[model samples]
Target: MSTLVSKVLVGSAMAVVSLFASIDINNASADELMTLNGIGKGKAEAIVAYRKNHCFKNANDLSSVKGIGSKIVEKNRKEITVGECKK
Candidate 1:
Protein backbone atom coordinates (compact mmCIF):
# COMPACT_ATOMS: atom_id res chain seq x y z
CA MET A 1 0.00 0.00 0.00
CA SER A 2 1.05 3.60 -0.50
CA THR A 3 2.55 5.44 2.52
CA LEU A 4 -0.49 7.67 2.84
CA VAL A 5 -2.85 4.67 2.74
CA SER A 6 -0.77 2.81 5.32
CA LYS A 7 -0.77 5.78 7.64
CA VAL A 8 -4.52 6.15 7.29
CA LEU A 9 -5.05 2.49 8.11
CA VAL A 10 -2.86 2.66 11.19
CA GLY A 11 -4.55 5.83 12.32
CA SER A 12 -7.97 4.28 11.86
CA ALA A 13 -6.95 1.22 13.88
CA MET A 14 -5.72 3.42 16.69
CA ALA A 15 -8.93 5.46 16.63
CA VAL A 16 -11.00 2.29 16.90
CA VAL A 17 -8.93 1.07 19.81
CA SER A 18 -9.30 4.38 21.57
CA LEU A 19 -13.09 4.14 21.30
CA PHE A 20 -13.18 1.19 23.66
CA ALA A 21 -13.81 2.29 27.25
CA SER A 22 -13.35 0.32 30.43
CA ILE A 23 -16.59 -1.58 31.10
CA ASP A 24 -17.97 -2.69 34.43
CA ILE A 25 -19.25 -6.23 34.07
CA ASN A 26 -21.57 -5.96 37.04
CA ASN A 27 -23.57 -3.04 35.72
CA ALA A 28 -22.82 -2.66 32.04
CA SER A 29 -25.63 -2.77 29.54
CA ALA A 30 -25.53 -5.10 26.55
CA ASP A 31 -24.53 -2.23 24.29
CA GLU A 32 -21.67 -1.30 26.59
CA LEU A 33 -20.39 -4.86 26.73
CA MET A 34 -20.57 -5.12 22.94
CA THR A 35 -17.86 -2.48 22.70
CA LEU A 36 -15.24 -5.02 23.69
CA ASN A 37 -13.35 -7.04 21.09
CA GLY A 38 -14.90 -10.53 20.62
CA ILE A 39 -18.11 -9.65 22.43
CA GLY A 40 -21.11 -9.64 20.11
CA LYS A 41 -24.81 -9.14 20.81
CA GLY A 42 -25.25 -12.71 22.02
CA LYS A 43 -22.28 -12.66 24.31
CA ALA A 44 -23.20 -9.22 25.59
CA GLU A 45 -26.67 -10.41 26.49
CA ALA A 46 -25.26 -13.47 28.14
CA ILE A 47 -23.02 -11.28 30.22
CA VAL A 48 -25.97 -9.23 31.43
CA ALA A 49 -27.89 -12.38 32.22
CA TYR A 50 -24.99 -13.85 34.11
CA ARG A 51 -24.45 -10.66 36.01
CA LYS A 52 -28.03 -10.74 37.17
CA ASN A 53 -27.21 -13.77 39.27
CA HIS A 54 -23.53 -13.37 39.99
CA CYS A 55 -21.24 -10.47 40.66
CA PHE A 56 -17.95 -10.22 38.86
CA LYS A 57 -15.13 -9.58 41.30
CA ASN A 58 -12.56 -9.05 38.58
CA ALA A 59 -11.94 -9.28 34.86
CA ASN A 60 -11.23 -13.01 35.05
CA ASP A 61 -14.71 -13.64 36.38
CA LEU A 62 -16.05 -12.96 32.88
CA SER A 63 -15.21 -16.57 32.05
CA SER A 64 -18.15 -17.71 34.13
CA VAL A 65 -20.58 -16.55 31.47
CA LYS A 66 -21.49 -19.19 28.92
CA GLY A 67 -19.46 -18.77 25.72
CA ILE A 68 -17.10 -16.35 27.45
CA GLY A 69 -13.83 -18.14 28.15
CA SER A 70 -10.43 -17.11 29.41
CA LYS A 71 -9.37 -16.07 25.92
CA ILE A 72 -12.22 -13.56 25.65
CA VAL A 73 -11.54 -12.30 29.13
CA GLU A 74 -7.84 -11.93 28.40
CA LYS A 75 -8.54 -10.17 25.14
CA ASN A 76 -10.72 -7.59 26.90
CA ARG A 77 -9.05 -7.47 30.31
CA LYS A 78 -7.64 -4.02 29.72
CA GLU A 79 -11.13 -2.72 28.94
CA ILE A 80 -13.08 -4.63 31.59
CA THR A 81 -13.71 -3.85 35.23
CA VAL A 82 -15.91 -4.93 38.12
CA GLY A 83 -16.87 -1.61 39.68
CA GLU A 84 -19.98 0.48 39.20
CA CYS A 85 -20.44 2.05 35.78
CA LYS A 86 -19.99 5.77 35.64
CA LYS A 87 -23.15 7.55 34.62
Candidate 2:
Protein backbone atom coordinates (compact mmCIF):
# COMPACT_ATOMS: atom_id res chain seq x y z
CA MET A 1 0.00 0.00 0.00
CA SER A 2 1.04 3.57 -0.66
CA THR A 3 2.07 5.88 2.21
CA LEU A 4 -1.05 8.03 1.76
CA VAL A 5 -3.30 4.99 1.87
CA SER A 6 -1.62 3.71 5.03
CA LYS A 7 -1.99 7.07 6.73
CA VAL A 8 -5.67 7.23 5.79
CA LEU A 9 -6.33 3.77 7.21
CA VAL A 10 -4.59 4.63 10.48
CA GLY A 11 -6.47 7.92 10.74
CA SER A 12 -9.81 6.25 10.12
CA ALA A 13 -9.12 3.62 12.78
CA MET A 14 -8.17 6.31 15.29
CA ALA A 15 -11.34 8.26 14.56
CA VAL A 16 -13.50 5.21 15.14
CA VAL A 17 -11.69 4.44 18.39
CA SER A 18 -12.18 8.00 19.66
CA LEU A 19 -15.85 7.99 18.69
CA PHE A 20 -16.55 4.99 20.92
CA ALA A 21 -14.22 6.06 23.72
CA SER A 22 -16.90 8.15 25.40
CA ILE A 23 -20.37 6.62 25.71
CA ASP A 24 -23.62 7.98 27.11
CA ILE A 25 -24.51 5.67 29.96
CA ASN A 26 -28.15 6.73 29.88
CA ASN A 27 -28.49 5.79 26.23
CA ALA A 28 -25.83 3.17 25.77
CA SER A 29 -26.56 -0.52 25.23
CA ALA A 30 -24.89 -3.18 27.34
CA ASP A 31 -22.19 -3.58 24.69
CA GLU A 32 -21.41 0.11 24.71
CA LEU A 33 -21.31 0.24 28.48
CA MET A 34 -18.84 -2.63 28.47
CA THR A 35 -16.37 -0.36 26.70
CA LEU A 36 -15.79 1.48 29.96
CA ASN A 37 -12.96 0.42 32.19
CA GLY A 38 -13.90 -2.34 34.71
CA ILE A 39 -17.46 -2.67 33.40
CA GLY A 40 -18.45 -6.13 32.21
CA LYS A 41 -21.65 -7.73 30.94
CA GLY A 42 -23.24 -8.00 34.37
CA LYS A 43 -22.41 -4.46 35.40
CA ALA A 44 -23.48 -3.15 32.02
CA GLU A 45 -26.81 -4.87 32.38
CA ALA A 46 -27.19 -3.47 35.87
CA ILE A 47 -26.64 0.01 34.52
CA VAL A 48 -29.32 -0.51 31.90
CA ALA A 49 -31.70 -1.91 34.46
CA TYR A 50 -31.10 0.97 36.86
CA ARG A 51 -31.65 3.51 34.10
CA LYS A 52 -35.00 2.00 33.34
CA ASN A 53 -36.29 3.11 36.76
CA HIS A 54 -34.18 6.23 37.13
CA CYS A 55 -32.70 8.46 34.49
CA PHE A 56 -29.14 9.59 34.88
CA LYS A 57 -28.56 13.32 35.09
CA ASN A 58 -24.79 13.11 35.07
CA ALA A 59 -21.90 10.64 35.14
CA ASN A 60 -22.02 10.58 38.91
CA ASP A 61 -25.49 9.10 38.79
CA LEU A 62 -23.96 5.78 37.76
CA SER A 63 -23.11 5.18 41.39
CA SER A 64 -26.78 4.59 42.08
CA VAL A 65 -26.63 1.31 40.19
CA LYS A 66 -26.32 -1.76 42.41
CA GLY A 67 -22.85 -2.82 41.31
CA ILE A 68 -21.51 0.62 40.59
CA GLY A 69 -19.78 2.80 43.13
CA SER A 70 -18.06 6.16 43.33
CA LYS A 71 -14.74 4.57 42.43
CA ILE A 72 -16.11 3.07 39.23
CA VAL A 73 -17.78 6.35 38.34
CA GLU A 74 -14.60 8.30 38.92
CA LYS A 75 -12.53 5.79 37.00
CA ASN A 76 -14.68 6.08 33.89
CA ARG A 77 -15.88 9.67 34.29
CA LYS A 78 -13.96 10.94 31.28
CA GLU A 79 -15.39 8.15 29.12
CA ILE A 80 -19.00 8.48 30.23
CA THR A 81 -21.84 10.92 29.60
CA VAL A 82 -25.55 11.42 30.29
CA GLY A 83 -26.51 12.74 26.84
CA GLU A 84 -29.31 11.31 24.76
CA CYS A 85 -28.21 8.70 22.27
CA LYS A 86 -28.90 9.27 18.59
CA LYS A 87 -31.19 6.66 17.13
Per-model TM values vs. the true structure: 0.73, 0.78
lDDT of 1 by residue, 1-87 (tens): 899999999999998876876888888889989989999999999988887777788898889899999999988888887896333
Which residue pairs does candidate 2 place in steric collision?
Answer: none
Displacement of residue 73 (Cα, Å) in model 1 is 0.6
lDDT of 2 by residue, 36-62 (tens): 888999999998888777888889888
Candidate 2 regions with alpha-carbon error over 4 angstroms: 1-8, 85-87
The local lDDT score (0 to 100) that residue 31 gets in candidate 2 is 92
